[model samples]
Target: MLNAFRARFWDLALGSAMTVLFALSGTAVALPLAVAQLLPLFWRRRFPAAALLIVGSATAAHTVLGMARAIGFFPATIALYTAATHGSPRVKWVLCPAVGVAMAAASAVRHGPVEGLLMAIVTVTVAWLAGMERSEHLRQRMERAAAEDRERLARRVHDSLARTVTVMLLQTEALRATTPLDSAAEQRIDTVLGAGRSALAEVREALAAAGSGPALGPRLEMLRGAGLRISGHPPARLPAPLQDITDRLITEAATNALRHDGPGTLLTITTVPGDGTLTVRLTTEPGGSASGSQRAGGGFGLVSLTADIHGYGGELTFGSRHPAGWQLEATFPALVPGHD
Candidate 1:
């Protein structure tokens, strides 16, 4: 409501100021001609083409009267600018040139033909160009803002939900291998794995649409390279976001294990998928040269990861395990709402 009032105030102010200027100009037809040209300023933005026509017609009348001064000049220029900025392309192209011709003809009657025509054409051209430049700048600014927002969302998705998904895939694969199951049970596990892969693909597509940089790639391999022995095979593909989260979790666990318990620490990761939820556990056992306590501080990475997990209705916990190890566990929805 306040914005509407502010806009109306400016429109009335411009029109009234122009009207008063012409009234005090001491020309015979100045007051009436200025009123006709400037009155449309109130609706110039809302009905640009019509406003331009009204202002242009008054300008033409001012020219025909052979007034020594062009009282309609300022109002006509403002109307032309509004048309170029807000009017439809067809209306803008058609009306703008017509207004320019009228102004040039008026100027020619008042001054020398060549000088007046060039001056009026230059003035009209400048106003139109200014409006076009402003429109382009606004468009570019909006695009930049949208791109930034997409990038931020992509990062959050990758860090939290994607990591959780990766752990689920790894654990499911492990469960298939170590435990003998009936054919029906095996098929169900395969379906779950397939769904995990599909979810990952969707995350990749979303990141691509957002124009984020390169994929994180093969988190399982990354963990193995960090000297953690792998007991289970990951699915053929994992979603980019989940893969990133899994990588961070595994990396942080491995680092803490090696740092606190010396090199050659054993790390175990497991996943259990229930009715509508999935649980992941990462345990670290001290190496031969173990020294410090297993209670590691929750760093910024874990804090951020915790927030991300909670955002999707998940829970996370990490601490010293028994008398000999450290463990981190998280449980979250198997499929986040609205994601499928």
Candidate 2:
């Protein structure tokens, strides 16, 4: 609404009326310069710096002529505000003061030094301050709106994509067990499954980057119900990255365990904090079927999990435990409060 009143044609019409009023008030001697000063108000919003320069030049011309100094002040004030509010930081900090000082010197030369300089200083200062305040308020409001948008997007990823990936994992595991497959078919299945799982982990990591994500507890429970027998009590407060990394580690370890072993296999998940390091360990019974499984590479999810852990100065080690099972252990440094 305010901008509409300051629109190009509207400003021109208003300026014309102001010019006619000044002429009627017996200040018509500087009519041409005053008119030139006010005319550029038409493009104040689109080209604030140029408008300020034009208006400032005209104001200086009329003030030096000692004919219509007051007539130009109104348009010059409006142009100053436009420059401060819409100009880039360099223009706002530098060009605005330069234009104001030039106009102030003209005003001081025309009127008495005390009154003319004070009027010029106060008018330009107040207008610039008002414009700067408004700019800062608008900037803060936009930042808040952007943060809310990111959180909303994170929630959507959690509710929709996370669940879809969970279902995909369960379906893939079940299909691998029931269906008989040749070597090529088994390799193809592993490739598809690993790709899907890696994509899901990447999505989770991205959402967590925005400081919002699904909790680890619910995801752990879902995995437990799917196939693997899991047991662990995670801490109440963990960094979002660590929680996400741990969740991926558990999912990948469980998937690999279920793929290799029979239904009787027991997978144990444990979280332990000691000596400034939080460790998550997954143990599974090893030595299952090798008929069509165990291709060239192991699980691709392991590679993804290793990168995630290493990013936080953590380490992940996996190999056969003492007598019967495989153990995958990830150790992360405990983060101080407010650091994460």
Against the true structure, candidate 2 reaches a TM-score of 0.55
Candidate 2: the clashing residue pairs are: none
How many steric overlaps are in each model, in order? 6, 0
Give the lDDT of residue 304 in candidate 2. 76
Go through the candidates in order and give each one's C-alpha lDDT: 0.68, 0.70
RMSD for all candidates, in order, please: 22.1, 19.4
RMSD of 1: 22.1
Which 10 consecutive positions of candidate 1 have the poorest summed lDDT? 233-242
Top candidate on TM-score is 1
